[model samples]
Target: MLAESPPETEQSAPPPVARPRHAARAAGLLIALAVLALVAVASIAVGAKPMSLDEVWHGLFHYSGTVNDVVVRDLRVPRTVLGVLVGLGLGLSGAVMQALTRNPLAEPGILGVNAGAAAAVVSAISFFGAATLDEFIWWAFLGAAVVSAAVYALGGSRSATPVRLALAGTAATAALVGYINAVQLMDTKALDKLRFWTVGSLASATMDTVEQVAPFLLLGVVLALTLGRPLNAMAMGDDTARALGAHLTRTRILSMTAITLLCGAATAACGPIAFVGLMVPHLARLVTGPDMRWVLAYSAVLSPVLLLGADVIGRVVTRPSELQVGIVTALIGGPVFIYLVRRKRMAQL
Candidate 1:
């Protein structure tokens, strides 16, 4: 009788890939890391002033407060470090979000973090007279955190579904973006202060900014990398995920927490960079297949490459006058967005 009662218990788990495929994926991941390292070096050495390799080396290891040293040590170094951190954060958050929502277009912004941070930063400049990057960063993080919590609650809290969360985020983003526009238009004096922050850039980064964001970024990275298993189960559908003993509610909560940490710190550090989150995960999934674990690994490694590469291009394209990294990424991300929309069915999660 006990044996006969188990007919319904035979649902299969997602099958593992063959060992050969695993080895190939691992090789690709290592190559991605190599690209990331090279991009980071380019970020430090190829800014507007264009330091040489020797200068970059001395700036990192030996410093004498010379002009080149200052440029290398004080400016490009922080920018490069922040770029990598922000890129990693965005990539991981994006990949995790797509996995959580099972929506091809899901990104960190889908939770309203970008809108929330923007609104808060605007308010700080317009209402609170917060003029410095220091002031805006704190307000941005606070706003992102609060709005994310609100969106979670609005989305149904413990019982939240992907559709509900997406709807809630859209609603919240619309409301906050409207508020930001009204405030900025009414208070044109604040526009100058808000303009660069809103559009996003890493030019304002300092060592202090790096210190402020490192802890949250590290924690978020760890949390996200660990979610590959449950997220993989989740990809198999909710009923199947439950059958596989995945803790759906806890996973959702943790996922949101990681997003808030990663996206909030990243936005606060360097405004809100676009497309790194939106596009990087899709690219990662393309290379790593549908396996959430490998996709996440690739996303983490490759996201920084896209971001810092964009940052370097932004520096060189305009000669003495550089474009913002945000602008550069937008220019790139727009075509990708169109391509995604035109496709009949996007590459699966």
Candidate 2:
């Protein structure tokens, strides 16, 4: 017994648990940036008219008074810039909406925000004769805010579930769409003006328009990025989020404000471009995991890449008569949406 007691063995420590690798995420971010740069250059160079890469470089860095330079500087440049800004806004807004509603399908286009803005702008055009985007910007902002508030109210208070939110969004969007069609039917002049706005194009992009919406876009982006932590908390269930000391009311209000600013400004600039919000967030999440901060970052970068790339494709595909970016995005997004649905990821919301 004394000999057996002398043979006690020692225990070893457990192996360290492995954390998720971030190098891949960083690489993905870099890849997105590279693609965005390439797409921006392609957007400038590969328009309906032929232009050399040298010309594009000169137009960007060293400008001379030439027709090619003018086209690059005046037309494509503004359009490309607007595309980037709008894409960023829409992409971030979509991620925010999904996080807020805890529904993957939630987006500005789906939630009646764009429809409300469209309705308001048409109302302003037909009734007030607001001919300029500058005049109608306020109308768009007001409409977006009102509709968002209405959706939240109908959806539920602080503890609204995703199903109720989605249902409320669908109902509001349908009602607004019907009203928009009625208004357009009544006023042919308004219809003519609304055609381009409703279709969504960067063709009419001007520096003035860029300047007008820049402030809103910048503010929205900053606010959205700041909300990453709160959003992450929210993704874990409302009770858990509250336990983590996340302010639900404040988060909701700020998130709604950010969405309004982003979507209203974007819809005003380039009609209601659908699917960017829906598609971009999904792609971003695939790269960034379930972390809202990384998801938002990836969405902001990749969205512009998709948007500008689509615009370039639209420009090159038709040759003489170019397709609008909205149409192009729809064509691309429809298949992607179908694929996602088939994958059964939609139910994961």
Best candidate, lDDT: 2
- For candidate 1, which ten residues in a row score worst on lDDT? 6-15
Q: If candidate 2 were superposed on the true structure by all CA atoms, what would the RMSD be?
A: 4.8
lDDT, residue 102, candidate 2: 83
lDDT for each residue of candidate 2 in 188-247, tens digit (9 for 90 to 100): 978878887886788889898999998999899999989999999988887999999999
lDDT of 2 at 279: 92
- Using TM-score as the measure, the top candidate is 2
Q: Can you give the TM-score per candidate against the true fold?
A: 0.85, 0.89
lDDT per residue (tens digit) for residues 238-284 in model 1: 89999999999999889988887888788877877777887988887
lDDT of 1: 0.83
CA lDDT of 34 in candidate 1?
Answer: 90
lDDT of each: 0.83, 0.85
Name the regions of candidate 2 deviating beyond 4 angstroms: 1-20, 156-164, 339-349
